[model samples]
Target: MAKYLRNLTCTALFSMTLPMTAAAEESEVQDMSDPLAVYTQAGLGYTDKGINVKVGQTYDTGSDTSMGMNVLEIKGFAGEALGWNGRGADDSIDSIRFRNFTVDLTNGLGGQVDISWDFDSNQGSASYSFIQALPKMGMFNFYHSLDLG
Candidate 1:
């Protein structure tokens, strides 16, 4: 009985000393350095840091021109505007927006027109829309991107 007990103790100690691996709260395909919220450690919609901001500007005052936006995707947007005399009724918009657009296909083929309305102007506060009849093309090609590592 004594010899059997000794062997059992030794076996238990050896098993405890053997190396073991534990799976973290991560996966093999997930990236640890990626900043996107999809695979982030803090979970979706959680901002680890205070804030991140980016700005861009384009100005061209040549002639009255219009551009057609075929496909536009706005992944993110953050803006700041000024108010009129700090009154809620007189608040105004002086802000910037971030949007990505693919308009090469409809650039010269489609004529562009922009129309706006405002309470500050002769026209009262309202909205406008421009409709277009596009010609169909038989051949269509889709653009895509792939990341393989």
Candidate 2:
């Protein structure tokens, strides 16, 4: 019975050593000589850093001079104005807005005209112009275009 117990103890000890040896062989040893190792160990990557603040302003100027015909005759508008917009990192601040603009019925068919500009992260600034005939049409249809930059 003593001999049997001794054999079992030796087998168990040998089996434990095999797993330790295999694990050591399978694992790789990293080179700590790299300068950025310390930062990497502290859970920092390429884009990880401090607060990033972005601020800027945008200027836009446009002009239109045309005497064209749609389904009906249309007048023309010729004016010059300077406009600017201030922005922050996100849209958490006020955006580009037009205030106190006057519209006069100089000639031709009277319609509803709307001009809007918005900012987006992926596609940048977008400007939209829409013109629709007033209560003349129930379907509410006219001409529209979008300028994405």
Candidate 3:
């Protein structure tokens, strides 16, 4: 009876390990020379629970030489689980979405500007808009504008 029990235990253990060994051999393992290749391979099995964002700003007390035009700027950004395929390989992510985003700018001369955008994948919708309120003289007065395209 002792010998029979030992044989049964060995058989059970070998049977369980056979499938695992086969699976490991079937999957190809490639040698990655670049760090980016390793990063994308490892990211395939990753997921996020959620996202958190914190926004802050700093004010400089030091004064700088300027042409006598005052400008105030406000900016913000927020989003969740936006994934990248890394090289257009189509790993798992299908689309991107943004909940809320905004930006505002104001000048000392009572000129103001606002920009906002919202995007979603489920509804297949996206919206982008901006508003400009400038004084009669205009927001900017420049001799030449730079265009890089």
Candidate 4:
């Protein structure tokens, strides 16, 4: 009976060891030489009374760098009221569009340019544009403008 018990213990230990060896062989990490890529997108919307606004951004990452674009649209009753009530109501009747272009250096640096335009039902419109650069640290410079028609 003691010999039989020892044989049973040896069989159980051998079975456990076999599975562990097989798992290790199957789980080895592969070598990867290609650059990694990533992509991202985001959207935001807000509404109050007759006003509605929406904004969205997207980015694409490549081998050693990345780039992105942003879009914003403003419309609805709130926009209409503000456009009409404000000094530039006539040109504000149509939708307002904004766009941003950006680049990522992949070395902890990047830059961007933004532009915007407002349209009216009567063919009148206004536009403004700006550009910015990135620094290693501290506050970066920015420029902006507004056109009331």
Best by lDDT: 4
Q: For every candidate structure, what is the RMSD over all alpha carbons to the true structure, in angstroms?
A: 24.2, 32.3, 23.8, 23.6
User: Residue 14's C-alpha lDDT in candidate 2?
Assistant: 30
Reference-based lDDT, residue 11, model 1? 39
Tens digits of per-residue lDDT for model 4 on 1-149?
Answer: 67446545543443231111112143544222111111222223222222445455454545346556565656543333322234433323245566554544454333334444434443424343333333424444332333223
Q: Relative to the true structure, how large is the alpha-carbon lDDT of every model?
A: 0.26, 0.24, 0.26, 0.38
Better of 2 and 3 by lDDT: 3
lDDT of 3 by residue, 40-148 (tens): 1110112121122222122232433211111222111111222222332223333333322122223312211222222223334434333232434554532221222
Candidate 2: Cα lDDT at 74? 12
Q: What stretches of model 3 exceed 4 Å from their correct place?
A: 1-50, 61-114, 121-149
lDDT of 2: 0.24
119, model 2: CA deviation in Å? 7.7
Residue-wise lDDT of candidate 1 within 24-121, one digit each (tens)?
A: 36655532221111221111110111112232222222333532222111111111111112233222322222322212233222222222233334
Better of 2 and 4 by TM-score: 4
- Whole-model alpha-carbon lDDT for candidate 3: 0.26
Model 4 has an lDDT value of: 0.38
Runs with alpha carbons beyond 4 Å of true place in candidate 2: 1-123, 128-130, 135-149
